[model samples]
Target: MLDGLTLDQMRVFVAVANSGSFRAGAGKVARVQSAVSHAIANLEAELGIALFDRSGHRPVLTPEGRALLANARDILLRVDAMRARARGLGEGVEPELSLVIDTLFPLEQVGAALTEMRAEYPSVAIRLSIEPLGGPVAGLLEQRCQLAVTVGEDFRDPRLELRALSAVPVVTVVAAGHPLARQAEGRTLAISDLADHLQIVLTDPTPLSEGRDFGVISPQTCRVNTQETKLALIRAGLGWGRLPLWEVERHLAEKQLVRLASHALGRSGLLVSESYLAHRIDAPLGPAARAFAQSLMQLSGPRSP
Candidate 1:
């Protein structure tokens, strides 16, 4: 009926819908519950449609409510993207970039990306810190790194701007001489099939599958930590596992290890995800950092020689 509702109102509406309660939404949107309720009430009055089916003990989206929820989320997300882009515009130009890359990342690809970055921003300094995944997030949050690379399910932090780098789903892998090598010739390897083999597994410093950890998989197994050790163990005919394609695809082609088969042992979409150059709300990033941020995005995908 009227376009008088504020962006804050729509944000509250979306948060309530997403969180399923005003209290939860307030926590999510970082406002008091009273403020959240007031925003939703204001939004409903301006829109001339009931945005929630409040009859339930908990808030539920009515048919009409569900319809508007989608549009409202779209609006708020675009507003966020715009805010980020507009902020980028003020960044003038960047001269140096500090990056903290995960230690498990393929060095070859990282080197290639850096080379392209160098050619494009010759004067820009590219400093890299290769650490465990936990360290990169802290580096970004603390302003130590302009960009970070991580995998697994996305975090709930609103400060970090995460971008999906790639998703090469997990595949089954075994040493060249494993008894199951021939069985993997066909598509789709099953987990139960590994019952007999000595499974050489990796214990990543942090969980690889994000919060979706199925639990400790104790195969008739040997445990390793870093990717290199696990790969070396696989080469020694230890056992089988679901591994990221980027890490093992080349080896599979080179006939070093045999990919068993696609499994339901699916990874968390096998993501090589990246986070933006971010600082807290009060701490603004400079033009040099902004330029480096753009360069990181441009250099993310598969690059040319």
Candidate 2:
């Protein structure tokens, strides 16, 4: 009975389930509503299960249908991957090389990589996404990207390979007019003194580092999703936080923000942030992807500061 089931039927089932009605699903699959209904009816007949409960205004998945929905999605994903791999084998270049990068990676380094990538693979399409905290790694895990440059900590997967990129300099900073800046009399402040103010923290939506505060100094904390937002808050004197030195160099020089003495904050004078270029071990990158990755690595190579 299951042998009669086809990919078309599975697609129709998924479309109807997602869209909530045969008419809506028809619009999605570009077929007539009757055709969509027929496909699902045939699929249900073959599987001998009532996939949808159509008694209500909207169709809802039956218990058996709910059990099979995940399997159907997985099958479709595998089929898509097989098709993509086959296409890549014939073309020698990926149709699109999706690259996700951490926002903390120097903009100049990314620009250098993109310049080289464009020169080497003019025809290959590049999809670039900038994320922060756990987002870069999440992009890789969720199959949104084929590669990533990440600075997230303690995140590892057996299916991924990590290549060392470069270390970014992280600095604790505050607006020049901030209370902490005003209180510091050209000396480091004690932990208790610092804890009185708000310490902005960068947090990820993902559960990667649940209940953890990476560099928070104060018990009073503000959590932000991205570094740019954190930087903006620091500049507004709403809170103080850490940012990559390269990112705040201009602000520091312009007197918009001032770097705190790390020793007074009970930290080393220097905190080096490490980044990595990561790709999946199971799905090796195509030529264009490899070239783009190499370009990023080349630009991020060791240099005397």
Candidate 3:
């Protein structure tokens, strides 16, 4: 059996659980399929227990696999902190900046700022990528990116600093034709009333895709990878799920969608996310990163006092 796993192995482990296939996971992580296969095999060996069971082409997580997921998350978080600090050393006065974010945030404000910034600093550029929660954090830690803006509290790295910018409202929604849409017009529901409901969820690790995290109250959940699908499912009256108020505003105004019910089901708790911009404390920022962070702050505007 292999010994301790490295940062690379932990990443591969996450990809497999996500993609559900070696080839697909490899493509996402930018590795060859065989390399992904080898990584998972070696990872299982190191842990002294089979993480996944070969049920066919796809692997199923054994009981042991579920236990290791948390550990892997911890290991990756530490490695990510080290990487950010290491990259800081290389960013001399001004270096290229990588900006990663959760798509659910109000991007319109930042989008305008970015356009203005490009004309102002043509020489400085930003590398941008969007993923669910862990991937963005991983990018910063892998030195693949410099800093990240994440939703939720998965970023518990002590080496970094986190800030709460705004408290966005989270509410359950469904397409107009759905059953929940009717409930919104009539009355609110109790937690136990949703036992037979199918909740449409955007299951990406990012905040925009966090409908499943409320599973304690929603036992019947369907995981969806894309925004279009979430809308489609809700429209088909197949499921109901939560979404950020920022994104749902226009739709609600247009009467395209409605809230699930007036009441909470299964002790549902709303997710109040603190937008965090994390960087290595030991490493000073390059001119580009600093300037960009400033621009981001300016674009984010101010929270109500």
Candidate 4:
């Protein structure tokens, strides 16, 4: 009789229980069906417990097997986690990671990625900063962050590298009660019509977006430092401006903000903006930083139309 069970045996047992058949479990573990059946049979004999009711076409977990299932899973998970941690250490995971992202990047996506990163790398300390326009790229240039998720065209900087992430659609929105929203309630607003209202714009800290404007029709503009403030001012009927469609989808559904139909901006009415992830050439990325970059890219698929 065996006093201790191997991780392979435990894996086979769990697979058989969950898959409810020896053949299916064999497929899952990539082993022959006879190998799976033998493993389970030996495991039951060694433990002196009938783990499954084998009378049926497909084996069903016996009461003892049900009780042992949770413990077996716990052990396999811990062992797998140990292997992952060792691999991560070998891959050079940084003790601390710093990141900067554009304020225009979807908050929901960022938040979800951050949550996943924390769970995957609880030992690594992470610091995140939010900036708009040039702030993201500037962070990498100044060594303020190891990685940056930014919006705009790629700059011709020899020391920096970037990957195109996703293109976000920009929607022109205003407070439901704003004059522009009321005026363009059922009709598309022309550039001339939009030029009459104040436009809310986010100011860039770096020269990247200096003297450049996108979808700004009005000569008069209200400049803000952050996206939150821009959204607030727009919601308060202070001004109208374009924002990422993902950022304002809930607000539009709630009727807190109204989308303007414009013939000039988007293909139909939505303007698309490109975003990228950048890192400095001199700064080699550690495991943690690389993982975060992957997370950022993965979320773009679901967010993109």
The best candidate by lDDT is: 4
lDDT measured at residue 68 in model 3 versus the true structure, 0 to 100: 87
Query: What's the number of clashes in each of the models?
Result: 4, 0, 8, 1
**lDDT tens string, model 2, 1-305?**
48998999999899998888889999999999999999999999999989999999888999999999888877876666676566656767667878888877887887788788878888888788887777778888898999988874567764567899988777788899998888764777777877898988878777766876566778999988887889999999987888887888899899999877757543533467678998765465788887888888888965322
| Cα lDDT over the full model 4 | 0.82
Candidate 3: lDDT over CA atoms? 0.68
Off by over 4 Å in 2: 1-91, 264-269, 303-305
- Could you give me the TM-score of model 2 versus the true structure? 0.68
Scored by TM-score, the top model is 2
Of the two candidates 1 and 4, the one with more favorable TM-score, higher being better, is 4
What CA RMSD would you report for each candidate?
A: 6.7, 7.5, 10.3, 16.6
**Model 3 C-alpha lDDT per residue in residues 254-274, reported as the tens digit of each score:** 888776653453123244556
| Model 1 local distance difference test score | 0.65
lDDT for each residue of candidate 1 in 68-125, tens digit (9 for 90 to 100): 8778877776677677667766765466678776654555556666676677667777
lDDT of 4 by residue, 1-305 (tens): 56667889999998988888998899999999999989988888889999999898778899999999988987876676566556656776689889899887876777777677778888989788999878888898889998888875633454567788888777889899999888887788888888898999988888866777755678999988888899999999998998888889999999999888888766546777688888876566777777777887888753543
Evaluate all candidate structures by whole-model CA lDDT and list the values in order: 0.65, 0.81, 0.68, 0.82
Model 3 ranges with Cα > 4 A deviation: 1-95, 204-216, 262-271, 302-305
The TM-scores, one per candidate, come to 0.59, 0.68, 0.61, 0.66
Error of 1 at 198 (Å): 2.6
